[model samples]
Target: MIDAIRDYWNHRIHDLEMTDQPVGTKRFFEDLDEYRFDKLHYLPRLVDFSGFRGQRLLEVGCGIGTDLVRFAKGGARVTGVDLSQTAIDLARKNFELNGVNAEELVAGNGEALPYADASFDVVYGHGVIQYTADAPRLIQELHRVLKPGGTGLFMVYNRVSWLNALSKVMQVALEHEDAPVLTKYSIGEFRQLLAPFAETSIVPERFPVKSRLHKGWKGVAFNTMFVGTFNALPRAWVRPLGWHLMAMCRK
Candidate 1:
């Protein structure tokens, strides 16, 4: 299963590293002209990249070095690891192109990180671990690499999200409900899985307002009609029902 994941990413990275497919609508933030389109949310101002200044940080799956570059530029001593050699190569090229550099970048597996234990002040993995077969193992690896009291953060699709509920309702309404397995996690489930490794918790607090949810008239209509209103709600109200479940743990 792990090898299958490596093979999957080896091929997937070709498109993921080079494409801009942010969710919501095609005309939203899906600007391919900007190479960093896929990574801006994880950067400062939006997600507090500046907080990493002078910190030792590791990004477990630094695709194309987008966030890695941001961290380095933010004054972090950054190191990156990814399962795909091609991704690491592209990341190096991107860093050079952007005049950003990291302390190290290596091709590596998330479930078995290559760094020494207790080596980093912060570790972050965004939208990466679900691709691996054993997310719990990856979490353990993340915990292992962090210094005591160090922070760890990750983003995974929320299985109990409003969008998920809508997907199921849509499927049932259309009489096309088929179980397509995706590695999604509910907040409680993720917290439980990581409890032994750290003081862990998760919150559903993001919506794909840029990437088109689906590629049809119905999808377009849904986004046009409901997405804006949904986003307009207070984050405190929307946090638990959001699409992306953010897990924060301390080791």
Candidate 2:
């Protein structure tokens, strides 16, 4: 089943890349941002790792290597791994297009990574864990590859959020809800899951208004109200309202 899904996405990526598209265009951000807010949220957290001039960084599930290129441009010795061959090919092409030097691109599984213990200074998995069959095991693998006290940045779907709940309902209504709720995570639950390996911190963020599929002031009003209400309360109080969740863990 997993291999079949991998093949499906691989084909999708190949079709997407054949069109020769840019990364941050309106189409790219609009399509991906509905569920992924990492690009907006990463820069703030990455400020701490700004001086990674000679550091080694590993990215798991690096689709098309968009973020890999950014890490390379920032001077990190970078490697990207993905299950999709098409994504790997696009990543290599993107690396050349962006003029960023990357060490390697490996096609493999995230649950059982192919790197040695304590091999990398930083390990990143953004918007990737939700799709894995065993997220905790993947986290453990990430922990295994990091040097002691090294950092890891991960993004997962927020289970205890209004937007996610709505998405679930929508899927059910559309008769497209066969897949398990693989993308959802709550802060407390995630912390407990990562407790054995690293100290974890959760940051809740709002998907930007610009990326909404609905146009005009009505769309803006709805998203703004939702985010404002959700962010106004503490997680204990509003854990059931936000759209997505991000967790940053240190190994």
lDDT winner? 1
lDDT of 1 by residue, 169-195 (tens): 765231111212147777777777678
Model 2 regions lying over 4 Å from their true place = 14-49, 168-181, 212-240
Q: Against the hidden true structure, what lDDT does model 2 obtain?
A: 0.67
Model 2 / residue 217 / CA error / Å = 12
Estimate the TM-score for candidate 2. Answer: 0.76
lDDT of 2 by residue, 143-231 (tens): 89899988788776676766666555544221112333255667788677777555777776544333334446655665667457655
Superposed by TM-score, candidate 2 places the C-alpha of residue 103 at a distance from the truth, in angstroms, of 0.8
Candidate 1: stretches off by over 4 Å: 14-46, 171-181, 208-213, 232-235
- C-alpha root-mean-square deviation, candidate 2: 4.9
Clash pairs detected, candidate 2: 159-185
